[model samples]
Target chain A: MPNRQITIAELPTDTLEPRHFQLTETDMPKPGEGEVLLRVILMSIDAANRSWMRGATYRDAVKAGDGMPTYAICEVMESNSPRIAKGDIVAAEATWADYTVTKAHKVQKMPKVEPLSHLMSVYGIAGKTAFHGLMSIGNPLPGETVLVSAAAGSVGGYVGQIAKALGCRVVGIAGGAEKCKWVEDELGFDACVDYREGNLSKKLAAACPNGVDIYFDNVGGKILESALNFMNERGRVVCCGAISQYDTDTPTGPRNLPGVVVVKRLRMEGFIVMDFAHDDAKCVRAMQHWVSTGQIKVFEDIVDGLENAPKALIGLLAGDNKGKRLVRVGADPK
Target chain B: MPNRQITIAELPTDTLEPRHFQLTETDMPKPGEGEVLLRVILMSIDAANRSWMRGATYRDAVKAGDGMPTYAICEVMESNSPRIAKGDIVAAEATWADYTVTKAHKVQKMPKVEPLSHLMSVYGIAGKTAFHGLMSIGNPLPGETVLVSAAAGSVGGYVGQIAKALGCRVVGIAGGAEKCKWVEDELGFDACVDYREGNLSKKLAAACPNGVDIYFDNVGGKILESALNFMNERGRVVCCGAISQYDTDTPTGPRNLPGVVVVKRLRMEGFIVMDFAHDDAKCVRAMQHWVSTGQIKVFEDIVDGLENAPKALIGLLAGDNKGKRLVRVGADPK
Candidate 1:
């Protein structure tokens, strides 16, 4: 069978638009000694893709003419490992391709959920990033106000739900009314601030009456400045992503950053999910339990076809997606 | 007796010159029920004086007509408290006055070193800030590279020595050849990059062959930008003070900050020494031991008389002081 792959043609100059990628067809290859033939089902679209396109993002950089970097839900079509077999579905780090091969160790066995697409969304890198950042990095205390930027998106959404679970007063910052409403009304966040509104600082201050104790920053710009200004003493800012500044070559720094950090004694740390990859099983187990008990509501914005993967990522970066932006490559063979 | 005091006549309009202060003589007040009358001996000039002059520096802003902000070494002239008595020398939170009063708890018992002047330099706020920031916050590991800005100054100097004692390779950033040489030779730092060199980035890169693991930042601006650029994975940048941006009405933010934190998985925290005030006993004890063992060195650039204090402070802000800047307000009681 022919394998259709989205490969990087060149680096982004003006913007991280879809034109930077070239969708090409290649011949499928046989699995190696311990590798599994993965039939890609669903691929995740993330701001991190922009990082991979430009340079390295905590891992290897995606070079020109290379397969575009991705994390996807896949099925084991063929395998040669003692631990794996055909027909098992899992989440793996594969290319933006229909079918690919990877070592069994690189893939995680997916637990049975209503929609297996979650294995790529909440149960995969996004959920794991939020879990590690909250638990290991932020560690928000009970009744503390947690302000999450991009709160309606994948990682930010999970971060809010988990903070809510931990008895925190969760406040989310989304771009529009629809996303903000979804975050507050559906996701059970205490309040959701529309950053598109002019008075971000005033609105944020009003929302968080006691000042922010934990700021899960995904968007970095004037919004970061607001959060930094509004942070209480010893506040923790978990730097998950900077979707707002990802496209710019020379992004402006937050002018008020250093002084506030000193005065408030704030701990601002940025981390990659793989930093706490050891906590994967534990986080997945807890998330599954939360989802099962109806305490956690998972939202996904799935775009059909692998052809739209680049567009989906571009839209995700631009804050146009409602929930977890994902590209459905093929039907899940369950 | 007449108490001559340096008080701010008005806030800084343009420059922090000596003329901004009005040295007025006032009647000496008697020790109240719980206050001890302090005969000021040594006054410490710091970058934080600039902060106190303009706005709050983890404390209330100094008003226009108020006694100029200061931290001084003093001999108790009279006392109404059980812990303090007349003629006993100590350090207290006093104004830039020949004689002042403070509560007993606010004054610390002076530990006997070779030179009692260290009570205002190595054992005072600068020392404590460096100790707490390096040990409690940065937590530099053995063999790691610690890059300190303003390395010839009090806090940054201490940071380098202590990091060196902890088995870390310490590199420093100073302005001129003289200061850089002093930082490297006298302070025992591995290398001191002269930031005044035309290509600061090239010089810094050459100094720190391995990326910076811990950055003890005092001068924040282009130096901070360079440090942010040179930071290693999981690096910690301790924001102690922003001496470079202190005089500015509008400080330019480090444009490359938030992104580097994410990419490097860096932990950047800014803090005041008062936040770890409880750790005073532990730090003083350790520092005394280090001093006795000759593991730590004390350097002082003492200016004569309280009249030179405003000048000392202005010069300190301008990076004119070679070491710890202090004013010999009066003769040492010992």
Candidate 2:
């Protein structure tokens, strides 16, 4: 099949929108020696992608007129490398297209789990981010209250579950009542606060009376400020992504940041998944065990077609998606 | 010589000034059982004192119509406790008055060293703040570049010296040409930037050819922003104090905080010295060794008279005083 692709036409000019992307068609290129041609099944639209378009991210900025960067689940249709075989499923980072051709080692062969989609959802980017943020940075103590922002979203969902699994009292902040309800009821959070409401502090206070020990922060700005105020002494703010503040040209950061840091003894650190390249297998292995044991729930809000990829990303940034927001590009394997 | 006293007349309401204190006379209280009467020789006027005056600090706030809270080096004039004797010098926290009656348990006996004034400077609060910030929080590598704000001030001066002692390259940021000269010439910093001059970023970049590995931030606002941009990957910002933004009712914090934290993989943590109460002896011992061995320099900008305690504190807050800003309450022991 011919690949349908979306490329960056304009960089985020102070604000990001669907109009910044341009969709185009390209003929499928044959796999070269020591390369694999994969049929992309799903393209993950993540917040970090917005960072790439603006400036240098974990990797180089996705240059203008280039395909949008993404993490994809794919099935190899053709192989020229001895390292990989055709018909093998893999997790790879490639451009946002219906198909991708890359060096064989660029992709990791997907492990066999009950639901193959779980590898792309909970055991994928979101799961790795959550695992690193919660386990490595946060070091949540058992029975300590762990508060997660964007709780119904991909990373936050798994963070709350992992905290709960580690014997923490889990509280979450989501965009709306339905997301909050889904997070609290379905994701096993002790309580979930709807940040859309004005009384976020009051609601959050009510949710975690002991105060927040570990805050898995995905959204920055006001929510971070509120969470900062609600932190326990020596609380950890793991800055996974600042999705809310990314689009602006000049950032108006948290005003109350300094005062709380001294008084609360807070340690706030930011990290990218690429920084843990050596430990990706360890993270994946742990996440796979959690999923296979039914200790974690995986949810995917899959939007169909490469044509809808730009809208999917815009929706994800706007807090419009219910789960791990993805653009499904092809039919599932028989 | 008898004692004189200064008491808080008004709590700081947005702006702090000399009129907030009242000059008064108090009869020197005699030491009761298990107690010591100290002749307050040097009152260390610190930024944390401002925090104490406004509201509760690491300890209770200095109440209006009462002596201000301070850390002081004093001479034990009379002692009822078996552990303390008259004529011994001691370091202690007490209400800021000429004669303070504290339990012998509350005071640490000053170690015998030349220029005993070093006890009130480097072997005191500034020493502890710098040591804890540089050694514990920053954990600066041998060849890493460390940039310090308020480099001529008490804490930043010590931080620069200690970083150099640990084999790290040191750059300092001070307010004026004289202070910059003092920081570079006397403090052994690799370079010093006069922040009063414009093009701070350019000056900083010139100073730090390799990006900053640790930023011992004392002044907040724009200087903090400038330092944030100069950070290397996985750099640590030890949030010791924000003396620049302390006076304001509403804080307008660093703007580039979010982007740099993500891009640089920064870890920013705040710490108060009181948090290391258990390790106080270790800090003092280390500081004493550095001071007695002439490995560290202790500079005190001593302002005379108990009548001027309020002025001394106000000057320290306004960045008027150099080195450890302290008010001499009594004559040095002969």
Q: Which one is best on lDDT?
A: 1
lDDT of 2 by residue, B1-334 (tens): 5556778888877778888888777677888889999988888888777877666645677788878878888889899988988999898887778889999998988875555667767877788899988888999889999999999998999999888877899999998899899888888889999988899999999999998999998977888988998898899999998887676677777777666786778999999887877787898888767767776888889988888888887878877777988888888887
Q: Which residue pairs in candidate 1 collide?
A: none
Candidate DockQ values, in order, are 0.78, 0.67
Clashing pairs in 2: none
Q: Taking the tens digit of each residue's C-alpha lDDT, what string does model 2 give over A1-334?
A: 5677889887777767777889888899789988999998888888778877777766897877888878888899999988888899888887888888999978888865545667778777788888887888899889899999999898999999888888999999999898889998888899999999789989988998999899988888888888898888889989888888787776777887676787778898988877776788898888768777877878888898888888888888889887788888887788
TM-score of chain A of each: 0.95, 0.94
> Over 4 Å off in model 1, which ranges?
A80-83, B13-15, B81-83, B111-114
Could you tell me every candidate's TM-score relative to the true structure?
0.96, 0.96
The 10-residue segment with the lowest total lDDT in model 2 chain A: A111-120
What does candidate 1's lDDT look like per residue over B195-291, in tens digits?
7767989988888899899999898877898889999999899988888877878887888768889988999998889889999999999887888
| Complex DockQ, candidate 1 | 0.78
State each model's CA lDDT, in order: 0.86, 0.84
On DockQ, the leading prediction is 1
Q: In every candidate, what fraction of the native interface contacts is reproduced?
A: 0.82, 0.58
